[model samples]
Target chain A: MNIQLIAEIMGTVAFAISGAMLAIERKMDLFGIVFLGIVTAAGGGFIRDMTLGIVPPAMFSSPMVLPLAILSSLAVCALVAWLYKGSDEELHGERFQWILNFTDAIGLGLFTVAGANTAIDSGYGDYHAFVIFLGMLTGVGGGMFRDVLAGIMPAVLRKHVYACASLVGAICYLGLLCAMPRGYAMFTGAMIVVVIRLLASHYKWNIPRVM
Target chain B: MNIQLIAEIMGTVAFAISGAMLAIERKMDLFGIVFLGIVTAAGGGFIRDMTLGIVPPAMFSSPMVLPLAILSSLAVCALVAWLYKGSDEELHGERFQWILNFTDAIGLGLFTVAGANTAIDSGYGDYHAFVIFLGMLTGVGGGMFRDVLAGIMPAVLRKHVYACASLVGAICYLGLLCAMPRGYAMFTGAMIVVVIRLLASHYKWNIPRVM
Candidate 1:
């Protein structure tokens, strides 16, 4: 499989699990759980595709992605069901945040590079902000949707260095592309985001709230 | 000016005002008010455009729409500021709901036609679901964005028969187009949505909560 495709699959799986976990935390119905999980898995790419004017999106154009989204959602939903099957107290627990953060960070890293490269491949190489925005959206857009649907402000708006990490990763990828081959540059960019995000979470680094 | 243009303008104004009002209710900062207002005015079209593969969107493509969005947002923000200047008690009052519902209904009517027409023009005429989905999204998508950003459940999910009204209007428009002129069909369709939405609100026709 292509390296880009590999990154995309990894990102999708990680993001889908994170979303499913959030749905469980919210105590949403089965429909809500499934819906939110699918949305979170696909929403970022949808946003990026839409912003780039790629109509029908990859989810509709290429059949594989949507099924992957559904399958991953099902897998995550199953995991959550099993995890909380015996106890109601664990339902509202914060114990899962560490695992969620880890998976989310992995997704953020891989997606940032994928989104930035996709933009560059689409002939938007000259537009710095466009590439960065697409990259950031691909990294965080699904989580934003999940949060919004759960009736909470998106973490991107106030959370610890989420968008910042994506921005940096995208910029790093774009810069590295000028000096290195695509594969190496992609790996470096993904690492940058993963490391930054993980460190930020561990250190509790946060963007100051405006309000 | 064209009838479609007139409808678009009216919808923009109504949506912008509705967004501004919601921002005020949330006690968001001035920037949030402006951001939410602009998003509400153009967000639906943005979604429609993206789904249909219209890149850069009309907001950036035509130039005129973005300014119109900004101007409408500013105008609405000013009106809200003026209205609530005297007291904070009335700020949280239910008095604004009437005006908000009226404007939202008008927007839904116009945007549904605009979205449906755009989809048909894009060669989606045979796909009934596509046309209806686009039409409904164009009508409610902006408000959904507004509500989500404000961290609330989307009104279409549980509120009055808003989605029903838009769906009926889109189907009506599509059916009418087979026999009538575009102008007549469009007018009739918009009226159907507006009337149905108004009636739904008046009668409190709500979709029951599943969860």
Candidate 2:
């Protein structure tokens, strides 16, 4: 399988798991958890497609992605249920949070590069702001929606360098795309995001609070 | 010149004002207020167009709307700034809330019909669920985004009969379109939302919360 395809599926699953876990934390029902998971997995691409004017977004175009998202969500739910054995308190501990953060950073990096490549492929590469916006949104939009649904401030706006990491990855992807093979640029760009995001969280870095 | 055009502009302005007020309440900067205002003014249509596969969205097509949204937000900011003379407390009275609610209801009703009509014009009239979904999202999406940005739960999910009222209006528009003239249907549908929303607020009608 192509790296792009693998990244897409992996990112979708990772993001879906993160979303489902947050929904569980929120005490949402099964349907809500599943719904939140699907939206979080797909919402960024949906927003990016809308911005780029791609009708019926790729989420709707390919039947595989939606089912994959659902399956991933179900798997996550089942695993978490078994691990916690229906104990909500156990699920809320620090260990699960570290896993969530690790997976989320990976998803952010993968989705950022994927989104940047899509925008470039769609003839938006020349517009740096547009490409960056699409890439950043594709990385962070789903999580923002998840946070909103959970009634919390979006981490992208307040948390440690999350959106900034995506922005850096997108910029790197676009910059390297002009000089290197697509695969190399994609790999390097995604890794940059993952590394920076991990470092930022570990160091407790955050954008300064204005208010 | 037409009622739809009038409604679109009016609703945009009303929504912008509501968003601006919320931004002020949150003590956001001028940039945040304007950003929230523009998103609230145009976010719904953006979502609807994406669903229908309209690339680039109507927001880009008409340069007029973006500027108009900005202008309205500025006007609102200026008015509130002047009214409060830079004191946040002065803007927090009960009267302002009543006015906010009054304008918000009108915007919701107008946006619901406009969204439904757009869906119908796009050949989604036959699919009642599609029309209803488009219409309701167009009405509620902006406010939801605004609330999320302000770190609060969306009113549609928590407030009295808000989404339900929009749903009623959207259903009414679709039903009436099957038998009546477009103008009549639009007017009736919008009025139905406005009246019901007003009555619901006055009567303290709320969807019951289970947990």
Candidate 3:
């Protein structure tokens, strides 16, 4: 498979897991968990497609995306059920959180590059600001949706360098596109985002709050 | 102007006001208020167009919509500032709430009909379920975005007969389309939604919650 296809699949699974985990934490039922998962995985692309006027959105056109999200979500749910097994212990220990963060960063990086590439292919390559915005939006939009549905402030808006990381990655992708092949630029761009996100999380880096 | 055009304009203004009012309540700055207002006014149409594959969405294509939303939001902000005059009193008294609810119902009803009509015009007239879903989504989608940005559960999901009212109105419109002129059907359908919503609010009617 091409790297872009692999990135899309991995990103979808990672985001689905992230959303399913959040839904479980929110004490949502099975349907809610699965729905949230699907939204978290596909919602960003849906928003991007809508903004760019891509009819039917990628989520609707690509048959495998929804199924992948659903299966990943169900798998997460089943795993949680088996692991907890009536125990009331909190599931968000440091190690578990690290795992979640790692997967989230991977999804963020892959999706961001993919979004930028889509925009470029759509003839927005000259519009650097728009391309970057679409990229960052694709990376963070689904998480925002998930957080909103879970009744929490969006992590992208408040915590860490979540959006900042995406922004940097998008810029890097745009810059690299000038000198390198599209495939290499995309790989490097995604890697940059994942690395930055991981480092930020590990070091407890944060953007300063106004208050 | 036609009734459909009038409905679109009125709905934009009403939803802009609603979003501006909420932003003020949240103590957001002027930029925040205006941004939220535009989103609340145009977000639904944006979503609807994207789903149906209409490029550049109506908000982008229709020059007046964004300006209308911005102006309406600013008007609300100015009015609130003038009325409050540095007072510490809460803005959400019973009368104020009634006004907000009334305007919201109007917007919801008008936008629902507009959305359904758009769907029908887009050659999806035979798809009853899709039409109804699009109608309800266009009606409530903006408010959902507003509430999510304000870090609250969407009002439509929790209280009143918001989506249900829209659903009924869409069905009514579809039915009336067979018996009446298109314009008349849209008018009556929108009126039905407004009436049902107002009555539900006035009577404190609510959908039963699982809990």
Candidate 4:
């Protein structure tokens, strides 16, 4: 498989898991869990496609995207059921937090670059601001939807350097595209986002919030 | 101006006022209030345009939409400031509730028909399900976004028959298209939604909830 395809699959799986876990935590019904999981994986693409005027959206056109999201979400649900067995114990521990952070960072990075690349391919390469904004939006939009459905302020808007990490990575991708092969630029940009996000999480970095 | 233009303007103003009022109730900053107001006014059209593959979306291409939303929101803000005068009296009474309901219903009805018309004009008239869905989505999408930003369950999904009202109206529009002119169909459909919503609200009609 190509690197871009791999990144897309990995990002989809990670986001599905993230969304399913949140739905479970919220004690939502089975339908809600699956719905949230699918939306979290694909909602950003929907937004991106709409803005870029891609009819039917990539998620709808791609045969595997929706199926992948469904399978991943179901797998998460099965795993959680097997492990917790309906217990009320907290789902987070050190290792769990680490896993969540790692997977989320990877998903954010991959999706951000993917979105930027799509924008570039769609003739938006000249619009640096729009490209970067689309990239960041693609990375954060799903999570924002998830949070909204869960009746909470979007975490990206409130806490951490999540969106900033995506923003910086998009900028890096745009800068590198001039000096390197497209694939290399994408890889490097995504890696930068992943690294920055991981470090920010480890250091508890947060943007200033107005109280 | 055409009937469609008039409906669009009224919808924009009503939705903006609704969003601004909610923001004020939540004690958000000025920026938050305006942002929420504009999103509530234009977010649905964004979703619709995106799905229909309309580049730049109508809100961006039509200079009046955004400016109108901003001005309407600002007017609401000014009026609220003048009336409340920084006092914490509750904003709702019988008259206030009636006005809010009347305006919201009108906005919902007009937007629903407008969205369905757009869908039909885009050559999706044969797809009955898609047309109805797009219409209902246009009616409720902005309020959904507004509620999400305000950290509350979407009112359309919960209290009243808000979305259902839009759905019925869309179906009515489609049905009426066979018997009347497009303008008459749109007007009649919108009126149906407003009446249904008002009646539902007055009678406290609610869908079954899973306890």
Considering only chain B, report the TM-score of each candidate against the true chain B: 0.91, 0.93, 0.95, 0.93
Q: After superposition, how far is residue A170 of candidate 2 from its true place, in Å?
A: 7.4
Report how far off residue A202 is in candidate 1 (Å): 2.6
Cα lDDT tens digits, model 3, A20-139, are: 888777776666677778889998887898789875567756767888999999998888888776764456666557766787888898899999888988999889999999999999
Measured against the true two-chain complex, the DockQ scores of the candidates, in the order shown, are 0.16, 0.16, 0.16, 0.14
Tens digits of per-residue lDDT for model 2, A115-189 = 977887897566565677678889998888888787777777566577778989999988998899888998899
Instruction: List candidate 1 segments past 4 Å from native.
Output: A126-133, A175-181, A205-211, B1-43, B50-117, B124-133, B145-153, B156-211
How well does candidate 3 match the true structure in TM-score terms? 0.63
Residue-level lDDT tens digits of model 1 in B1-211: 4776777777888888888878888889888988887898888989898789776776677656667767877876787778778788876667788777787888888999989888888886766666876898899899889988988778765564767788899999989989998889989999999899888877876443222
| TM-scores, all models, native as reference | 0.63, 0.63, 0.63, 0.63
After superposition, candidate 4 runs with Cα above 4 Å error? A1-117, A124-136, A145-153, A156-211, B92-97, B178-180, B205-211
| Model 3: CAPRI class | incorrect
The residue pairs in collision within model 1 are: none
Q: Interface RMSDs of all predictions? A: 5.5, 5.3, 6.0, 5.7
DockQ for candidate 2, please give it. Answer: 0.16
Q: Give the alpha carbon lDDT tens digit for every residue of A1-211 in model 4.
A: 4766777778889888888887887889999989988898898878887789787889889887899989988998899888878566656556655665676777788889888888878986766766876788788888788878977667675545777789899999999989998789888999999999889878887543111
Worst 10 residues of 3 chain B by lDDT: B202-211
DockQ of 4: 0.14
Candidate 3 at B52: error in angstroms?
5.5
